[model samples]
Target: MKLLKLVPDDTNIDFMKWRKIAFGISLALMIASVVLVGVRGLNFGVDFVGGQMIRVTFTQTAEAPVAKLRDTVGALGYGSPSIQRFGAPNEVSIRMRLPKEAEGQTGAAATMTNAIVGSIQKDYPGARVDGVDSVSGKVSDELFQKGTIALLAAMVAIAIYIWVRFEWQFGVGGLAALAHDVTLTFGFFALTQLEFDLNIIAALLTIIGYSLNDTIVVYDRIRENLKKYRKMEIGELINLSINETLSRTVMTSLTMVIVLVAMLLLGPETIFGFTAAMTLGIVVGTYSSIYWGAPILVWLKVGPDSFVPVGDKPGAPGRDREGYTR
Candidate 1:
């Protein structure tokens, strides 16, 4: 579990220059992503957009791959099918927009299922259709709304928790960083034209939790340092806090990125979007912790006075490295 060693001494690293560069890059990417989202939009899955999903398993390993199956399914008078491997090589899932021509028919689902199975059989001999699932447009819409609300609820809860844990300023800065990460991740999806599905929503929530954890660690260090060095310039104090926490921050993020990268490369295609979003968040969250959250503390003019003990002079309780209450 110890993938990284914690640095014992705080190294004074000047991250302001890197912060500027990071800001410029993230801003440009975010704007481009927004534009892509507006113009091209995300490739929504059947769960978000109403469609028919058929799960088919081959009797043996599929001689014809999912791409070929998609092509064959498209030739059967259906729209381009979204074909992807399911649990195993023998299992594949296909989703297609519901045919308008079958709107009112009682056996539309059955008819669509049979047609897809027939198409698979024709293209790849010995293919067997396991099951078909259909969701009406209304149901999909409801799920989308529910997922959105849940995300909003989680953000609110996190903000309140941070506010109670530290101060309103810390809460505000942490929330801003959280929003930065989430928006940038959304921008990536929009820019990349990746599929937006229920799993994508889950990935986003995971990002929120992770980004908050990063922000909290930095904020906690800043709060502790603020009480230790009361008269130092706010900017310098913030910079020093970033340096103090930099080692831990980088080590944690780097480890997470390594795991996510492996999953991105070797994991199933179904989670490609999810893992990609997480990978992006891992990088963004780390940057925001320093550049986004730390700068906010500076701009807020936070100093040792913000959390100084009422009965003692500033730095009076500053103990030695032993951490005793002086």
Candidate 2:
């Protein structure tokens, strides 16, 4: 029986033919993301912006709890605290910016938390604070620094791994693609004003891994093709490798996208930012793996010599004309 295929197995696509256009589009969007970030800035969550977050659970179901909670907190003169459903329908999370008077005051977060809870208790007899957490400006800054460091470290590690497994050219190409994916993902968040918290950072790391995996698959095929088709030009070899792996790449990306989209639509608002980031990452990662990664090899002047074993020149001693030892 013939197997059904989403993409033809013997497909021959000239992916590299549109490299210039892809690069231009990617560059334009990346620049726009940077501008957006600089101008409007990120909508950082309480975790990164030095604020208080209180999770509360009500004893009974409440109608329009988000609006109720928001109004309640706003009436308390807290400068319009953000209130939204935390996880379950009965649970709500309230976040408030640090008041100027509370800044650097000892036990300010705890004092503020108690005041908020006490005020809410008057309206809802059985409502109880599930959890309370606070981040000072210094701590928030430190967390932001650490998160940035972690992202950079992950990218560097990915580059090093690729360099070890393949040629330096391949390593550079893979890293470029990874960077491209990450930048575009960030661009999406900036454009949409999604919350940039630790969870989003986690999604960014996952994107790097996903894009790296895809690029490595294509690179492996390119390496194999280099050995098999020694006479093929580097450009032709790259095109062949990408075409050979296109089906697998498309299937993998499509599967991931389907799952992510389901999560985005069905998951709770708590993870909306994460799911959105991941969804964007998958699409960008797949594109970079195909267009950005392979084209870089050509620009770097990669050829058959890059893959051939050192000292295994053609017709050398026991080696045959194909550089194989007898």
Candidate 3:
């Protein structure tokens, strides 16, 4: 439901002021994210970092305290284990990076599990070793390669689609805007050391889709305005196009942000990474659609005369209700 209107009318708004403010804000956030990325690296999950996941379940609700369980696992010589409550207080999961000595053993998975299980049993005899899984370095490498390929393929496909649907300049601007959003998101993730896993990849793709969709809306308006505002300067046309579509952009983005915020509050932790990334993307996407996307069209020499005619194109419509001919 529409809670409240976020943006007012598009008519007679200060285009230059808003676009400049948007650009400044986007650049500032992106730069801050980059600095953070440089200072703190991303926390790659077991899927990328290569580790073991140990799950334990107690027979009864009052079996053992979480602290006791962690202490038991810690004494096993597992280095820096991440302990978290899984399904319930009685269920706990711990993930730890295996020692370098167990790197390439043929049955490294079973060996690691057995070692951890033996240690856990020594402390808590009643705790059940629910499951143990090992992720090889080779597997992480494979996943890294596959995730890269998927992201590149998506970017290429989107560029091609936009180019085919609109002009070459439109496609280029759309891609630039997409890159801005992705890089900013990555910067934020890296700075925070948020676990980069399959879920993060999913979030990146969702951002790509969201950013591209925003670009398309603004581009559609630019295309329409080019035909209507004949003799208008390129910057003026772009600014006007953005202003014309501003209402729709804010409305659409606000709705999605509302849903995403709900998920952020009530969603499972499994989806927390994805939701957070998308939430940032939605904010950046909205800004880029008007600032980054439209500004690029101006830089590319796209002008009103490209779509409209001074007199008439070689073969196109004459004049219309707007007095602009295609």
Candidate 4:
């Protein structure tokens, strides 16, 4: 029986051939992402915005009346409520932001939850209250601040670690790729107006780790090849390293994407944004490892001589295009 190969062992695609174009597109997207975030902004959920969340199930209905429920809740003078089905079709989660004055009042959330639940139970009998949750304005403000700090801290720490593990240039390249992945994910949420919450934070952190792992793999190969082929041009050497790791990269990314896509289509609605962010991360992370991460080495002056000994150049060894000694 023969084994499968998504990328053949002898493959030598010139990934760097599109480095300029890729970076051009990346710059445009990053700038656009910033603009989108600034203009459209993120649609924060109850977790960060401090709100009353009520969960209920309509026992008699096959599907929750989303439109009617919206109208009913909207008329409550509680403003618009964010409602979405979670597990079963009859169940839904409703989130209502608290007013500034109401935030300081005790049992305010409970009062609002009771009112909404009462209205639903009266109009539609057999409505069962599942649970209620609340967060104070101060608490949500703290949460938002802490989440921001956590993301920034994680990215900076990853950059510092890469700098220590590899070189400053590699660290810069890795960090740039991370920023690109994260920023674009944020942009997607802003554009689509998905609920940005603690779950999305976890997804961002996961994406950082994923992008870093891919960067380290390609950088490690580049380092090894630099020492092995001391006479190879930096461009060709970087291209070789990327192509060498292309098979593993493609396999790992494909596997994750398949699982994530499945989750996105068939999984629960609560994790939809999480899955979407990861799906986008896998794609951008793989691309950065190839085009953005590896090619940046050339611009930063990394070459075959980078890993050479301090004293003297070693004897020139004749090597084939595949990086093997002749």
Candidate 5:
């Protein structure tokens, strides 16, 4: 029986032919993403913005009283609480916004959190305050700073590694692709106003890794082709390399997206943001690896000669018609 093939054996697509179009679209989206982030800004979660997150479980109940809890918390003068079921139906995370007076005051935030917990326990005997997190303004700011640094550091380090492993041109291309993926992710958050937390940071890091992995696969093939196809034009060589790896890319990305889409539709509310971010990242990463990562090489003047030595002549002896030694 013939095996199922997503991308055929003789797959030959001219991805390079549309490099200009891809680059233009990427540039415009990147600029627009940057602008959205600057103007609308991300809706930082309690992890980044100072606040209290209290985890509660009702041991005897099948589901927590969301409406009553909202009213109870609201009546306590702590402002309206954002409550959502996380794990079991009876368990939930209650997020309370830190008041202006409580800003930078860890003691005040803690006291407020304790009071809310105390009120819930009194009102419902089954209520159990499992966890309480109180982050001060200063601490949240520090966390935000560290998260940004981690992202930038990871992207730069990946680029440098690709440069050493392949070529400087590949490194630039990889970095550009990473930038595109990350910028669009941030843009997504800015546009949706989803709560940006350390969890989302984790998602972004994962996206970067995915993007790098895919880009590396393509870059590796491109490098191999450069040595073998000395007579091939740069654009055509890159197109061939991408097509060669297209099957793996499609299968990997398709499976991943299928799982992510399922999670988005059926997963818990707690991981909704995380799943959503990753879903977008996966798609954006794959596109960048194909379009941005491979095409940039052509524009950067990469050719078969790049892999050849300074004094090596065309069709050197011992080399096959394609160029590499037999």
Candidate 6:
């Protein structure tokens, strides 16, 4: 039986021909993201900022709506708790920043949770607290530090892996593409003021893995073609490699995007930020694999000689008569 084909097996598209244009666009967007993040900052969630979070579920459908919950909580003098539907209509999560005086106070979170629960239950009978979590300022600071370290560590590991597996040029290109995907994803979160929590950090790491896998695939093909087509120009070889993997790339990205879109539209508000970030990452990752990752090889001056053994040259170290790196 014939297999399904989303992109032709014999594709010959010149993807690297427009590298300059694509680079320009990516640079502009990255700079804009940096500016937005610097000016507006991220909308950190309770996990990153000290806060008390309460999840409540109503036993009856006659419970108050979201707006009423907000109003009810607001009237309690907590300064308008951030209330939103959690997983279902009957479930809601209320988050409030800890007061200055309440910070570092023992058992403050539990006492606050009890008070909020009591206040809400009075208005809507059968309403009970499903979960309660509290983060202190010290804990939040530690979390932020660890999260940043994890991201940097992941990037460094990826760069080292690529450098060892391929040449330095390929490593640089892969890092560049990963950086582009990550920056754009962060930019999306910053521009939209999405909650920057641990889940979103997971999404960012997931994006790094996905984008790196795609870049490696392209780099592998380029490596093979460099040895086979010695006369081909670097630009032509890069384009050929991308076209060769275009079908697989499109299929993988499309499959991921379909699932991510479903989650974005139907998933709970708690994971909306996660799904949105993943969706953006998939799109950006695919584009960078094609346009940003492979095209950087040209700027790095990676030619056929780069892929050959150092000992292949006459009088080089570790020379061998059979042309193999002895």
Q: What TM-score against the true fold does each predicted structure earn?
A: 0.80, 0.85, 0.76, 0.81, 0.85, 0.83
lDDT tens per residue, model 6, 68-143: 7877877877554777777877888898877657767887777777778888899988887898877778898899
Model 1 lDDT, residue 301, Cα: 74
Alpha-carbon RMSD to native, per candidate: 4.8, 3.8, 4.9, 5.1, 3.9, 4.3
After best superposition, candidate 1 residue 254: deviation in angstroms?
Answer: 1.4
Task: Judging by lDDT, tell me the better candidate of 1 and 4.
Answer: 4
Off by over 4 Å in 3: 1-4, 18-40, 55-94, 99-127, 262-270, 308-325
Off by over 4 Å in 1: 1-10, 17-32, 60-92, 98-112, 124-126, 309-326
**Of 4 and 6, the candidate ranking higher by TM-score:** 6
lDDT of 4 at 170: 88
- Pairs that collide in candidate 3 are none
Q: Report lDDT per candidate.
A: 0.79, 0.83, 0.77, 0.86, 0.88, 0.84
Write model 2 residue lDDT over 1-326, tens digit each, in one string.
99989989789888888988988998898888888878877877666779898889997765336666777777877565766777777888888867767777888777777788998888887887888877778888888899999989999898999888888888898888988888777777778887788889899999898999899999999988877787899888899999999899989999999999999998756688999999999998999988899999999998876765555566554533355543
Question: What is the descending lDDT order?
Answer: 5, 4, 6, 2, 1, 3
Residue 92, model 1, lDDT: 82
Best model number under lDDT: 5
Better of 4 and 6 by lDDT: 4
Using TM-score as the yardstick, the better of models 2 and 6 is 2
Per-model clash counts, in order, read 0, 0, 0, 0, 0, 0
Cα miss at 206, model 2 (Å)? 0.8
Models sorted by TM-score, best on top: 5, 2, 6, 4, 1, 3
Prediction 2 global C-alpha lDDT: 0.83
Better of 1 and 3 by TM-score: 1
**Which ten-residue region of model 6 has the weakest summed lDDT?**
317-326
Better of 2 and 5 by lDDT: 5
Position 205, candidate 2: lDDT:
91
